[model samples]
Target: MSGKTRIALVTGGSGGIGRVVATRLAADGMTVVVHYAGNPAPAEEVAKEIAGAGGSAVTLQADVTEPERVRELFDAVEQQFGGVDVVVNTAGVMILKPVTELDVDDLDRMLRLNVRGAFLVSQEAARRLRAGGALINFATTVRKLALPTYAGYAASKAAVEALTPILAKELRGRDVTVNAVAPGPTATPFFFKGKPQEVIDQMSKAAPLERLGEPADAAEAVAFLAGPARWVNGQTVFVNGGVI
Candidate 1:
């Protein structure tokens, strides 16, 4: 922490877990690259908060599923921050549907964003991340729970988990660690939106902790993996409060 300020790139910095993770990394002394796909306002707000707190941050927009956009994102980070020390892929879309009823467009959208997007961003990060830097991808507890309506979404996250070990091995010589975090039933706006209050309460109580996970809860795990946890590689740390 005494050398050059670390640089962290967090995809989907406009939303729940990503926003919290970016802010926490800034607080931890990393110069943050807050990346958003379509929403710049919220991303800028997160960066502004970091700046107000005396931390350094910038916002970049990229559709990570597109290889060219992903490349541009890394280039912008390099231009601004000099080099990247940590990369977090938290940009994702979830469309819940039973396999038989799943829309083809929705399936493709999830695959493109959750799987292809993650791979592209991770590849770029792997190329640029310094030795001792970390690459973190966001997965989901649905991969384990196999909930009825989440087949496609879970399949995509399962791909992410599959890619984690391969990327870790690919980056082994560089001393760059790769891992995934799977969070369950978080109390993010996305989770509570349009859902019945009773259903939300039931889901919250299902976890052993008897509460929905918070954005800060997952961010804590991301922060740990980003720093001072070199031994934890190619692993998926579940931040589900023992729901699974």
Candidate 2:
């Protein structure tokens, strides 16, 4: 990299993992665009923290599943920051249910937000990124474990995984790297809300690391992929702490 201020667009930047990724990237000196789907408060909070820490950041609201909105999101980033150097797709929805109980609408929603959203964001990033930039997509360890009630969500992540290789090839000779990060049972609000403490404890003990993953832990991996890791491309770095 040329040591210029790099720009990063993190989708779902208002949420737990996304917030950590955005903050960490900013701390690493990358100008961050915190993209949120519905709520802007959390995104703005993150942006303010970055600024307070002497880093540059901005909060933007956009539904990644919408092509026009995604285009606008990137356009605004380009207008403000010159161009994007890193793109992370953390926008996802989980509607857990057995395959038999999965509603068509729910399935469509998962596919739209998880699969199509990643594709659209990656496409735009590929089109706009400066050479040596990186694109990181969020997948899940559920694809490996094949857990019950997560078929739809897992399938969506699997689609993301499948796209990484082709995207890497498509971006060949451009010096931009594409990759995915799959986190397992992280200690995010989404994983803890409404869940029994006993169940959470048991789940934590199942991982080889003997605790739930932290958002910062996953964000660390994301940071690596975004900068100074150009050699690691077209791969899924599983951040489940050795969980099978």
Candidate 3:
């Protein structure tokens, strides 16, 4: 590694998978910019934790779906860290419902965040990431499983999986990788929000591993794609314990 440390911008780092990704990258010695959309408390705590552990971190906020706010976010990162070498976009919302049962607003919200928001983030990252950079988008194993009540969410993430490789090719000789990490049912507040034990148990048994994935497990994959995995561009690396 060179004396010049790498910089990372982890969107949605306020909590869950994003927070873990930020912390792990910091441990890898990259100065991380933890991004949040609304509240900054969780992000601030994350930054403090990173600093306390001898890693460098700073918290920033932006609306992932909006272009101007996203631009402002990259500006903040540039001013603070010189340039970004890794961009792990974990900012998204998952609203599950059967396609027939979903209201227009529900579908709209999911598409805006999961699809449009990811596009906007990729656009900015493509424009700004320095050489040897990476852009890892988030997808879910549900797209592969085709389970009930995930119609809208699955469709949006499927789009993410589809576009990721093309983005990698677009970057051509830039040496920036573009990939998507698709995690199985992870044990997090977002995953357990309203499910009963039986439903959770059923899901737990659905995967061959018979357990929900940990957020840290997915983070490890992202860390790999961000650093030293230059040949891993343009693919959806499934972090789901063989959950086909």
TM-score for each predicted model, relative to the true structure: 0.97, 0.97, 0.97
Candidate 2, residue 103: Cα displacement in angstroms equals: 1.9
Q: How many Å off is the CA of 51 in candidate 3?
A: 1.1
lDDT (0-100) at residue 234 of candidate 2?
A: 95
lDDT (C-alpha, whole model) for all candidates = 0.92, 0.92, 0.91
What does the lDDT come to for candidate 1? Answer: 0.92
Q: Residue-wise lDDT of candidate 3 within 1-244, one digit each (tens)?
A: 3468999999899899998999999999999999999888999999999999999998888998999999999998898878888899898888877778888898899889889989999999999989878999998888988988888889999999998999999999897899999999999899998788999998888778889899999999999998889899899998888878
Tens digit of lDDT per residue, candidate 2, span 1-244?
A: 8978899999999888999999999999899999999878889899999999999988998888879999999999999988889999998888888999999999999999999999999889889989989999999998998877889999999999999978999988999999999999999887887568997898898787799999998999999999889899999999998998
Colliding residue pairs in candidate 1:
none
* Candidate 2 Cα outliers beyond 4 Å, as residue runs: none
Question: 2 or 3: which has the higher TM-score?
Answer: 3
Error of 1 at 225 (Å): 0.3
Clashing pairs in 3: none
